[model samples]
Structure formats: structure tokens, C-alpha cells
Target: MGRKEEEFGYLLDNNAANTEVHTKTGSTDQCSQHSSTETHKSLESTYLGSDDDEVRRSQAGQSCDYGEEEGHLVYHIGLLLEERYEVVSTLGAGAFGKVVECFDRDKGLRAAVKIVRKFESFREVAKSEITVLKEINMLDDDNRFACVRMLEWFEHQGHVCMVFELLGLSTYEVLCQTDFLPYSVDQIRDMAFQIFKAVSFLHRNKLTHTDLKPENILFVCSDYNLEYNNDTKRDERRMRSLDVKVVDFGTATFDHEHHQSLVSTRHYRAPEIILDLGWNQSCDVWSLACVLMEYYLGQTLFPTHDSKEHLAMMEKIIGPIPPHLLKLTSKQHYVHNQRLDFDESSPSGEYVRKHCKPLKHLQRKSEGERQLFDLLGCMLEYDVSRRITLEEALWHPFFSPMRTQKKKRS
Candidate 1:
């Protein structure tokens, strides 16, 4: 809407040093909110409905007869918008919007543009995402968090298009390709350190990434590998190269903001979120701990589907919730007295039985193993007040190996 030509030059000229990382974590129910049918589309549209000639004009072009999914507009490869970005490919499609790989003609950079449908809810989400990103981006000049950098954004047709730097494979992609083999301790340490820095940066600044997970964490470089050997018989040393950037800020909220009860993916969710207790940055630390454990064990630490079962698994693994925290939680019905006395144990028991061995596998007698457990214990601490803070985690002994290794390499 402003100086279109000058903004393109400024975006491309911006380097990694200017990239800001604002993290977002989400809940299964919160995620599902985006996945609902035509009813959701209408709600989002109603929420974002504004008296704009451009919106009505754009709506006129959106025909239900088009092959696009219901409530979604049709997008095709090679369709250029705003006379700046050309859609090279569709990266992924979600309930409200689709991400596309676009070639920025002005900057000659491959950018990922998230095109949100002109509906009000989608528009609000896009705008909120932009505001958070800008706030975080303004804080750091060195790009320590490795957050996906936002480039220029604009409105095209009836959609709000957000452009970001294109990043490489997600941790999920690497995990799947490697057949879920656990990363070596050293590699895991390095990865966790980077992740910790990102989380620390956000926490120190009073921001929280509610959705930290394998899928949202990605490698910063395209050429780095996690080291996999398909020949099962050969004994090969594990490759340790790693540098990750956290992405997806759709659900991130500030510390002062009203925290959501149902936030973050179920597996990595913190107890505060599950119990409807007020939460803060500690919630992200909880998710980060789960993520680190998965990196070392190649599976989710708590893999239950339902909230009660999830709480049960937490009890089994992390022990019962402290009384103080129990009182703070809104959903105390799940807890009986001082312990988590569940009426039915089938759902919780099912995953617990299978993962019991893997859970035990983490309890090696080695000192390194003990340190890992200590850090995890603090991170997974049920009480948000006593749980390890991001800064404390960075100073934890668990990362000493990474610090020593970095010094030696230097």
C-alpha cells in the first residue's frame, strides 16, 4: 500500500543478522480450530469482515464452482501476484491458508509466502503473526534465535500475503528419513543448545513460543545432514552436524498476554496448559525438554492422546503433581487428593506400557546420562513456578559438553 518498490530492495538487503525469531506453540484443540469445515470459514470471515471495496471485489472472484477446497481460493504454480513474487510451488496447505515457494523478482531470493484467505479470522491471524515477528525482530541484531525472518508483506487480490525466508528440512523430516534413530549425545547437546538459545532469547524478552516441536524446528542450512547409514550391519560413527532455526509463530503470545488453557501440541504440552493453570514462558521450557528427549530417544516423552491419560503418563514418568500446583490448576477433578488417581487407566496404560522400556533406556548409569536426567527433571518440573527457566537451562551442566566442544573447536 505504501512505497512498493523501495520496500522490495530493503527486504532483500536485510541479512540473517536482522532476522528475528518469535516462537509459537499450539494445542491439538487449538490446531483443530484451524481445521474445521465451512462453518469455521464463515466465522473467520465474519470476524475479519470489514467494509472494503477490495475485499468485496476479491470475494466476487472467489467462485464456489472453482476446484479449490471449500472456503479456500484456488492457487496455481506460475501465477504471479503484486508484480513482485511469482509462485514457484505450493509448500503446504492448511485449513485457513497455504504456504508457497515464491521467487522474489526484486530480490532474487526464494521466499516462502503464506497466503491467508481474505476472511477476517485469517486476516487477524496474519496481522498478529506479523506484529509478533516485528517485535521480536526488533530486539536482536545477531539473529541468535534463528527465527524464520519475515520479509515484506502485502495484500494481493483478496488475500494477505506474508513473505519469509525459505528454510531447509524440518527436524521431523530428518527424523522420519533416519528411521527415528536417536542422535548421538554430542549432536543432541549441540542441537539443544541452539534451541535453548532461541527459547532463552524469547523468554528473557517476555515472549513465549507455545508450539515448540520437531516439525516446527528446522535446519538452518540446506546441506547439513544428521548422518544415517542404511547398511544396518556396518558400525559407522554417528554424524553430528546441526544448526537449527525455529519456525511457525502463529500461536506465540507475550508473557503479559492472557495465556490460553489449551495450547501446544498434546505430546509436548505443559501441565499448566492441561490443568488450565495460568502459564508463562516456563511452558515453552517444558515443551523444549520434551523435544530434547525426543531428539535423544527418537520418540515423544509423553505420547498419550487424551488429557487425563497425558496427566497419568506425566505422573508415571515425572511423578505426581505438587500440592501447590494442584491447587493452582483449574482442572483439579483429574487429581484425587495428592495423587493422580484416575478412574480409568486403559488409555494412559496403553502408551505407558509400550514406552516403558524406552523410558528406562534413558536411565543409563553414565555421568553424562545423569546430567541429562537432571536437566530434564528441572525442565519437566510440574510446577511452573519452580520449573527451570530458559536462562537457567542455558547455564545447566548438561550443556557443558557443548560449551567444551565449542571451545576446543575454536
Candidate 2:
């Protein structure tokens, strides 16, 4: 690895900048394949089937007796690993594997252990997540950034278990429990500020969180209050603390990594990804924009999953895509005459026209609301080159209060 890459534990892919991702490798399954820097290279090697003498020597006493629950690693409540982490209960489960709440005997605290599935693909992705997390831990040892802290990791049996700081409910879980009521402007400000700060920090380090969404954004403490809502004629849940952290870095990519053709959950996907025009850090900005919008509205900003309809909806909400970008896209089937080709009279087309309206319509005359939408506009800019970077977004008019508060504190 180059010195620059070694310094950061990853190098930039100069040749892959315009290298379009051509597969169905969206954020759900996409994982980084770059070699790690010297700092965490051994850690990666150990967790990724330590075959070398140094790695095998370092991981000498660890057990290799892992069994699977369906496709995920099997772990029962009260099961202990390394005689340090005692399983408390299952936190959640998905394709990646299961996250179990563990009692950390050594640290005398709780941690969330992500037991990766045994599949080759899943294990590889988990290794990638570990690499990124180790890099994040090294980069932000002071914990100034809002990304989740991976306390440690180890291979148990065949499962590469990752121990994370047990956090509160994901924003999606809270939003669901609250019956889909949106957050107040002040609340969104606090949460978005932290999220943007984290993204800025990652971008500064040349990492891009390709799958950012509400579910991936979690509260550090999800304690909330039940407040009466006159308009909804029922009680609504209000977050007691707006503090949040970004999670799920299995798809996080360094600038030097191979650019996956598709990334991000469908609703939050950037236009460039859909059009196959290639992407970079700006894609993170676009997903962040969708995420902030979801927090404000208590629902996904873009509700559909179809590519053509999604583009049509984008046109309806944020004006047309620039013809030059349309012409440049490798996804020619989705474009015609330097414009998105779609039937306006079709049922899907009707759905687009019905579900989406101009961004102006979603805003009110209130300064906060106006400024928030204005910021979203800059973020959702069709031209990736013109979209506001998180660093720039942090200084927008909407976050004036955050800046002022910082000034007061300093």
C-alpha cells in the first residue's frame, strides 16, 4: 500500500473513479475488497480466517466451534464467549446475521455483538465492516464523531463476532412506535447536525457510507416522552435527546475502493446511481438529504422502488435532470433524447404524478421550514457536482442555531 493509504489504512482508487458499477451490487450486498493498511491489517487478517503464521499465532487459543441457526450463527442466551462476553438476549437479526445484547464481564457493561452469518459472502462483508470499524476507531479514538464505536472483535467458532457499544432504538423503530409522527424542527436540527457532522468526518477521511437511511441512524439514548398532539388527536412520542449515531458500515467504501454500480436503499438512492453515471462522496450527500427529509416527514421522501418512476418523481419534485447528465449516463435504456423516457399516462406514471409534488409545496412560510427545504434542495440537486457537500451543508442557514450554540460554548 502507498504511504497515503497506509496512513489511513486504505488507499484511493484513482482508476476506478469513472469506473461504473455494472452489476446488481446495490448497498444491500455490496462490500469493499481493498487491502487494509498496516495499522489494522493484522486484525483484518485474523478475523478473515487467519492463515498466516503471525495471524494464526496471534489467534492461537480462540475456539473454532461455530454452528449455524438456519444461515446465522447460533448463540443461546447465557452462552459465553472468550469467557468475557455473556449473551443476554437477541437484539435483532437479518441477512448479515444476528446482533445479541451481551454482558461484557471484562468491561462490566453491555455490548451488542454482531454474529455474522457463515456464508462466504456474508463473512466477507463482515470482514469489510470490521476493517472500516477498526479504521473509524483509530481515526476517532476520542469519540468526537457520531459513528458507532466498535469496542472490539474476535472470531468465535466460525462466526466473526463484532462487539459494538449497545445503543438505543434506530430512528426507524422510534418513528414506527410513534405512529409515524414527524419530528419538530429543533429536534431535526440537533439530529441532522450530528449526522452531517459524522458524514463530514467520514468524507474528510475519504470514506462514504453508501447505505445511509433512517433505520441505519440510531439514537444514543432513545428515552422519550409521550406528548399530546392536538392535530393528530392522540399522543405522540417525542425524543428526550436528539443525539444519534450512524451504523451499518458493511457497505461503507473508501475513495480508493471499487465503486459498486448500485448502492443505498432504493428510496434514498441518488439519481446518478439510478442512471449509472457513476458516483463518489456526493452520493452520500444525496442519501443524507433523503434521510433528513424522512425525519421531518416521518416517512420516506421518495416512496417508490422503480427506477423510471423514481426519476419521474424526482423531476416532479426537484425539476428535470440536466440533459448533459442524462446523455452521459451508461444506463441508456432509462434515457432517451437526453431526457428520462417514461410513459406519462401509464399507471406507474400516474402514481408518480399523484405521490410527488414540487418541493416548494412541502414547505411553509416559517423560516426554519423554508431554510430546511432550501437546504434539502441544494442537497438533492440533480447534478452531483452541484449537490451540497456535508461540510457545506453544516453551514447552511438552517443550522445557524447549531453554529451559534457552538460559538457560545467555545
lDDT (10s digit) by residue, model 2, range 109-210: 998787876766667767888899999999999999999998888988888898888777667656655656677777889899999999899999999988
Tell me the whole-model lDDT of each prediction, alpha carbons only.
0.63, 0.70
Question: How many Å off is the CA of 287 in candidate 2?
Answer: 0.6
Give a tens-digit lDDT track for model 1, residues 1-410.
23321112111100111112111112222212222222111111111111111222332233222124654557787888788899987665544466677899998888878777667766776687788888778886567576777877888877888888876666654554455655656667788898888878887788887878766777765344443457434222343347788776767788787655556665677888778776788889999888888776665576445577778777767776787777766676876786665754464465555454434456667677788878888888887778888788878898987778778989
Candidate that would win on TM-score: 2
RMSD score of candidate 2 (Å): 11.9
Clashes of each: 6, 3
Query: By lDDT, who's the top model here?
Result: 2
Query: For model 1, which pairs clash?
Result: 24-211, 25-210, 25-211, 26-264, 27-264, 48-120
Pairs with steric clashes in candidate 2:
12-256, 13-256, 21-261
How far off is residue 107 in model 1, in Å?
2.0
